[model samples]
Target: MTQTEAAPVTAAPVDAETYAQIVQFYSHHMQLLDNAEAEEWADGFTEDGVFAQNVKPEPTRGRDTIAASMRRGVDRLKGRDVVRRHWLSMVVADRVDADSVRTKYYAVVFETPAGGKASVYLSTTGEDTLVREDGRWRIRHRLINHDGA
Candidate 1:
């Protein structure tokens, strides 16, 4: 007898309203990060959310910790006249439940220094688990996998 592996299960298609809400969520998230609104960006997550990167072994958990980390990064760039933008594309979302969604998207981080042309600083893929809390979609867990990693 031979053993065979089963195929992965795909999520069901979401309704128009759910799809629109997800798109808006991503847009607002990107906007907050690009504008260096660390606190606001962190607020997009649940109280006990987790943010992990492929390059790092440990994940950042909780809103306070997440906000602090973002603030530190912002402080490090305080003296530099650099503009950072997060461009997200190829977004695919799966509904986990009526109030939860799982999504994956491609991300490109572009940086423009002073008057210089914009260049790609990082390219990565992100997997996020979002849940509706208090009538808003908030990220419960996010994993960022860097390109070529």
Candidate 2:
């Protein structure tokens, strides 16, 4: 008798309720950033959260540091007349455990100058680890891998 290999088993997908919650969380997250609400954006993270980008070698640790970093970016754009928007697509969430989830999504950043058409500024894929803190889903870590970077 010949032995046959078994097909790979995949993890169960997130339920619709969980998926909707995550979507709402992400929507609020992006809106805060787009509106330059740095502190509020940071509040979406845990106290010891991490944020990293492909271009940066070091990750920003802690919510305070993350908020400051976001503020700095907002400051740079203050006088530039540029409106930045983050578009997320193809978000897939997997349950890591009872109170934690891992998500992968595609992110596209668009920039529209005053009186100008919006154009894609950056495109990247992101992996995020989210944990339930204080009965709300908060980002524990986020790693953004820029396309071609």
Candidate 3:
């Protein structure tokens, strides 16, 4: 009889590190949107992924659709300057599988008029599903649930 020592094995990967990456990505995304960099923001998603502004309606599929929706919003506020901010918090990401993750977060958007006369607010919470493709993570689906009228 012979006995051999087994090879050293690493610990099972925790979801925390991956969740942190997703949180960082979301922060970057918020910055991009705040700067009105729609094209850059749209680049965060996969080719066939979706961005849903509202939960009731179907998501805006593809980068083109997402970009177009962003463009329309940007164009609507063209002349009159408006600054928008997205406050995201309480991000919860779970590893659904080896290459898939699900996350939930709350978003509060505040907007100020050019003259600073009045401020408008809209808040929503969202569920996001992400997938790792080619060693990179991209948002696969997003569903936003608005909290107000």
Would you estimate the TM-scores of all the predictions?
0.91, 0.92, 0.81
lDDT of all predictions: 0.87, 0.90, 0.77
Instruction: List model 1 lDDT by residue over 1-149, tens digit each.
Output: 13352212254666778879888888898899878899999999999999999999899999999999998987777679899888887878877788988888899999999989989999999989899999889999999999988
* Order of candidate numbers by TM-score, starting with the best: 2, 1, 3
Question: Which number leads on lDDT?
Answer: 2
In candidate 3, position 65 carries an lDDT of 86
Off by over 4 Å in 2: 1-10
User: lDDT per residue, candidate 2, 28-85, as tens digits?
Assistant: 8999999999999999989999999989989999999999999999989988989999
Runs off by more than 4 Å, candidate 3: 1-14, 115-120
Q: Compose the digit string of candidate 3's lDDT tens values, residues 5-95.
A: 2211222332677867888889998898888788888887888888877544576889878888887777776666888888788876776
Worst 10 residues of 1 by lDDT: 1-10
Best by the TM-score measure: 2
Clashing pairs in 2: none
Off by over 4 Å in 1: 1-9
lDDT head-to-head 2 vs 3, winner: 2
